[model samples]
Target: MPEIAGYRVSRVVGTGGMSTVYLGTQLSLGREVAIKVMLPEALADEVSRRRFENEARTIARLEHPHIVGIHEVGRTADGLPWYAMPHLPRGHVGQRRLTGDPQRVREILRALLSALAFAHARGVIHRDVKAENVLFDEADRPLLADFGIALRRGHGTRVTMTGLAVGSTAYMAPEQARGQQVDHRADLYSVGVLAWEMLTGELPYKADDALAMAIQHAQSPLPKLPPGLRQWQSFMDRALAKSPRKRFPDATQMLAALERVPLSGGSHGARLQDFAYGAAARLQRLPKPAWVAVGLVCAAAIGLGMPWRHLAEDVADGEAAPASSASSPTDASSVSAAAMAPGNGGIADGGAATMHGAAPLSVADQAIERARERMRTGRLATPNGESALDSLLEAVRAEAGHPQLAVASTALLDALGESATGAIVAGRDAEATHLLQAAARVQEAASPSASARANHRARVDKALRARIAIASRRVNRTDALRLVEHARVAGLPDATVQQLRAQAERIPDLQGRDPGNLDGMVVLDGATRPLAAFVSPVSRAGYARFAEVTGREPALCRERISLLRVLDRRDWTTPGFEQGGGDPVVCVSWKDAEAYAQWLGQRDGYRYRLPTTAEAASLAAAGGARIVSEWRADCTANCSRRTVAGASWRTDSASRTLDPDRGYDDVGFRLVREL
Candidate 1:
């Protein structure tokens, strides 16, 4: 209840294993604040203390608006450590005060992903991304919180123990479940799963225990989803893929996918309600088959002459079809058969009888045929000696006789193969590859006589070998060479193998560099100024901000204010400016950095951006002289001196800088812009 460090801790708001969060108020700013105090147990252990210190240092370096801001860290009278952050008004999504509307869910998810993308760029991985870790402001804007299990590059020691997965099991990525080394992709997977839950009100996977859930994540298929999620199925499939490479590489890409899904429905609730009502209405309606059977039964009973006049009258009236003469044998027989059907008289099994006869073609068939005809007339036109390939294929498939079908299919397949080869010759490699693969699958599936089948297979084999050679010449030379060698050993034609080998030889070795690097590069704005910072290497101090800013207890208010300014200045650049690195640079909060990066990108050519936490670490670890010097003992002394001159700085002569033996305070940074 006592006031300290310009804030009054009213009461404990929440508690975690390492710290207790208190609802507090900043007297000067007249704003609510959330203060977290390190548990006494953490302070008692040296390793835990170091980790706590590192968390504070890492949190202070991030400068994104979507991230929770770290205001200050101090010690209570009893020597317990605590840190202050902006008080978020809204609680976790799982608290269930009222079910949030879909729009709110989507908005919250978008903000969280954006924040995560920022943190990831700077080499920080929030191993725990879940509803509980996200908070909302008074206006309901989402703020990503709780980076307790965040992993920093070049920081080998983990805050948590081995075999102990840090994130909620429901959101853990497959690799994380397996306890394998993970990267930014794991976070993307979690975001995707969370989004799925928000939309459908269900998790993609579920189990009774953590280990079982992990196993299910690794081995089981995705849970059966409600209808109408087909649009998002492809993205979900990729995101939930067991392999990390298959998921979107980061949260930014996942955000792009989410944006692509149209938000046409007013909100999730309204759409769901409409759908439910529509389904109920459909169930209430009389089935068409029942009516058809009823008509048939009435007609038959009339023909049988069992007080039949009324039956005939009813049947004719209901169907609006002309009544048949009872004297005609054909009409009588047909009527009797119809009446005996189960749907009408309950005498015959209508479904079985209907199946015995050739089923009438549905209206849907006509629609499909019309579409096909239009396509044929437009893109598949036969002109100037060119034949319509799709038309030919359709005609072949429709042929009644096996021999005729075999001949026609073979001809069509051969023509497609030639077309594919022509495309390759014309230097359209992508089209050629697609065409060849399609043709191969078609030929393999076609039905033909044994001799014809063997001949077609031979032709396809030669074409496939040629296509493989062409592909090998383009890229992936090693894979191509192995394929060629395998084909040769399998007794493929020597001429084809030789051609493949020759093509493979022509491919330049682009090995060691990533083939997908160009695709992965972020395009930033040209008009915006790019802000950049560096992260500090994580150290083993208690998970308290006091350990980060002061490296020990501060004796004067001047030192505390200086630390605040340092943190405030850290927000100048956005998270997008940093690239992934494994070393520490200037760290700011995630939310602040995201705002700066976004603003800069908008003002510039959209290329001005912040580097992810991972990217920042990468640049730092690259060992440029400037970066290395920025973290040196000499550099710290120089920076400290410069700050004193540049600002109205104060120092306590009686108080000494704490832990002079440790190097945690040597973090520094620089800024950059695209040329």
Candidate 2:
């Protein structure tokens, strides 16, 4: 251990299970570097030693900036293997989460993906791509490190019976976890898991043990991601698919997918930069008095400059006696003399003296007096409990002419009404509803002259009418439909309209069929282009998995495109997509899928979009019935089947059959470009 040969060891920078990383300087080139030396125990095994040496040599051949640069590799004085790499000045990937801005996350992914694409192109597969393996440089640029587990082409079966999986459990692709042969697609899967963790702060799958986790990855469906992530879901889903072929064909494809995410609008990087600059400018413009107060407080805590006794004496001389207090004549004369003392220089020279004889209060004293008065009357309590309501009433009476306060009072009353309406809808007792109504009335009275007061009253009436409609629907179907029609004229949002319609449709009508059947049904063909103008359908399993990952309901989850394709002309009226262009968009990633659907709505006259999960399940069930075998029937029949080459096709009928001879491994889908 006489300082590794050819390098001057400075200090131990980091240590891992099999190696010790030291800060070093290469004497030959006068360059700083990180020297990683394999542990003696690991080197004791001849096979492990050979593997380590081989990996180090393999890494040395990599030349991408995003990949950690391996400068040299050789044996130490005692025959131990050691390798030197460029020293990265920045810290680990986990450190970036403190700010948790999405832009930084994207930048990290971009660099990592670039590195992966480079390696994949060179026929190298880095089996491990988790956050911990990714390092950051001084400029917050990401650098991939620890290629020890990387598998190179022509490397004969390196699997060992160590009982430990090759990749980290959380980021392992399903096939990899099952000990199946893996390719570059496995690496892409790991990157996808890492990206999901960075953006949403949670893994899509979790279990108590590694075995359970492996099972989840192998058998369980990809989880539904967070709502509003409609843009990221498709990429994430493809990357996390249960089968290797279902994932990106290779790292290059994944990189292209990453590029397609909408980064120009609402980009996390631009927003954060704007926020930081604004905050810095605001800090610079703070008043001098505030700065002085902060400095004084800090100084006082440490018993540094300025005596407490002197500070108290100055305060006493500057503050006037309270109007309710009577001072003795002798004491008053003493105070006057103290203020006029020659040692004080003059009234103009000392601020304390100027206020003394004038009987004017210091700003600090006035502030304290006002605070004390407010405390006595409890006027500062917030609007949560009993004190809040009392304070609200007083504020309204004191500032009746102030439009803002008047509006605030009215808003509070309206919120109360809404809460009551929720409780009633949830099946609370009549007594509880009566109590809530009483509370709303009292709040209404507090701001009688305000415009909000009228709004609150109107809201209460609407809630009552809604409740009546619900009651009528349970008893008489015809009347309920009429009531919902009436509500429509009053300007309800589409969701509300749909809900009302759903309720009316539920009752069995005169035709002997459930009236709800007339509301229409949405059908989705997974292989065909997604419906351009209907609610996007998702598999029930997909929806449940998504909820588990994001902690949000399926309905709230945003839709995304699962395949690469243009919108059909017929699908322009979907919920979220509402744009029109005929370009062959390459990066039209899944999250953008939903936006495209919504955009289609404006081009066409009806709603067009991805089917909801319920709709997707129904369609799948129907298709499943048509095919007489397991959906996983070998790739020969269903060309659209999830497989590596299937990534290219928008749809492949050859994939839909049960006969293995007729299947093709590369079939999948693309959304319709137009109706």
Candidate 3:
């Protein structure tokens, strides 16, 4: 990696057209950081360099918790300017599974909007508010990143490439797409697009190319939500208004509007209306004797009409009005019949059955009520028969066709979604997969319409896919294989399951067997023969033995200190942390690992060497959870550096190249025997 003046550049984490992001260490104070270095091409342009520096300075001033803070700014040896930020390893919001969980969706939006509101107050417009820019910290709190394209007030847009659109095309607002002078509202529009994606698992607009997408944002009508997501429609409508004026005026207003969004698929009033319609339809089927009874009740109600408005007020306030006062003639007849029926819980106890008297509470109504109670108590799907899911299933079996069924189903789905989200946030992929499957089953059983079923399944599948993607990155081979089959059983599309299976197959499986007794090594099946590899990085005790036998001085250590490299006093034995004899050694150079490999090969009468990149990748994927990165036998950049594969305890990144002769505190190596 090209040396940045003040930061110890590790390897490239991501690369874009204008810049590269490095997972780096800030030598001063020993901090792990992400360093964004402007590409030499972009740096060569005086305007681009100036714009980068100016935005870096401006964004550095933003100190909100949800905003990625710029720690220090400097230039590389080649004079490419770079800035450092806290290295957040939970990945970006784009990688998270957030569909069907409005609580989480709202939480993310609120955090981002709070960040935006803070920046907007200082006259900085993020310009880009897409999913990729919203990153999560280790705690899973979101931080708005990459404000390189942010526009500050009074700075003409010409500083950026003039007439060329800024911001991601997929999330661009109408004004941004038109390249018109924009304000904070444009960012709000982008957030609206993001919200739509989170709720629907697809972008609001899709096209063949960026230009087409931008045009759609500028001209196409806002897309209607699916039937199950209609509660968010009004919120989406105002948030995605094509005209800037029609959109939420600021992040604060947008936050307020998001708060107002109903938690279910439909509004309470809408549910009430559906119930009214369903009741009217059923009323026509009443027998003549029942109609006569209703007529007498109506006469009695008219005799006491003055109390009707007060009863309506009480019911609207969620307080149960007295049955005699609240019930219309029709409701009185329905209640009288319900009072005589046999049921369970609230209905059998005569509590909810007589209230409102809109309809008789069936076994389904009691079961749904129990489900709601279970949900409130957080007994979602555990403890077997007493779970909210169990109650919901009972309600489904009863097939009472209660208006509350729709709301109850949505609530269960949302609860399961939120729980699954919590599991994902906690890095429990297996648990998350199980929860999503539960949600899918519930949707399958409860959703009546083909479209509703499809929509619900799609939502569940989106979350499962995201969870599976996360597992693909960090889970072991066994877990990956399990998830592949689990996903198939969960009824995900066959193509998706097949693709996941294919990816999981890349991770070598140990098949539930312990590693061979060949010095804590595992024998992996090979194309031609068996290959034995260390299941963990070479330990301190093992490396010490090699060094003692060879009588070689510890490889020259050079740690990157702020603005310069200094000879590090620490070595494999004292890598700045207390270590067990079996603990993996750090501060060992690739040369050290290679030398030990040669020594061990001679001693064991076998060819032992650093694993090849492909082997390393497979091993890394199947290594389970690890904190140290391992050196691989892959050379890069004229053999000056070798590949370091695996995730560090602090990062979710895959692999990077480092100098083979220099030891890093967190880098080690594992050996593979060529059989």
Candidate with best lDDT: 3
* Candidate number of the best TM-score: 3
Model 2 per-residue lDDT tens digits across residues 557-639: 11233333225221112213321121112222233334444553455544544333333333443321121111231233344
Q: Which stretches of candidate 2 lie over 4 Å from their true place?
A: 98-100, 159-164, 263-675
**What value of lDDT does candidate 1 attain over all alpha carbons?**
0.51
Q: Write the per-residue lDDT of candidate 1 for residues 1-675, one digit (tens) a residue.
A: 544656767898888878888999877467888888888888987656766676676677676778887876767666777778888877876653322365566677678877876677568888878878778778777788877677887775365567656678889988888777788888888887777777677778878998898888888987544434544555677778788877765564466455444453334444333222222222223354544555455445544543233333334334322344333222233222222232322223344343224232223222223223222222222332233334434544454332334543454444444444334433445555555554554455454345544554464455456555444323455655654543343234688678667766554454643232121122122223222222232211211232344343221111123666555432212222332222232332222223334444455543333343324433444233233212211213633421100001122321122222222122232223332
User: 162, model 2: CA deviation in Å?
Assistant: 8.8
lDDT of each: 0.51, 0.51, 0.70
Query: Alpha carbon lDDT of residue 285, candidate 1?
Result: 37
Candidate 1 differs from the real structure by a C-alpha RMSD in angstroms, to one decimal, of 19.1
> Tens-digit lDDT track for model 3 on 1-675?
978654567788999878888898766357899888888888678766776887687777887789988766766777777888889888887888788687899999989987887788678999989999999988889999888788888887876666778789999998888888888899999999999999889999999999999999989988778756766876888889999888776675566456546677454345444333233223334543443343344335435642332333223233334655433323233223232223322223334534344455566766776686566445678768998889889988888466777877776776665555445433456776777788777877775345545554565455455555544333246666665655665566788788777766754454554333353455453323345676778877778888889986776455565433344366776677666455678888999888999998788577788887766534643352277888888998899988988777645668888889888878878888754
By lDDT rank, best first, the candidates go: 3, 2, 1
Per-candidate TM-scores read 0.42, 0.39, 0.44
Decoy 1 TM-score against native: 0.42
Clashes of each: 81, 72, 0
Q: Higher lDDT: candidate 1 or 3?
A: 3
**Candidate 3 overall Cα lDDT vs. reference?**
0.70
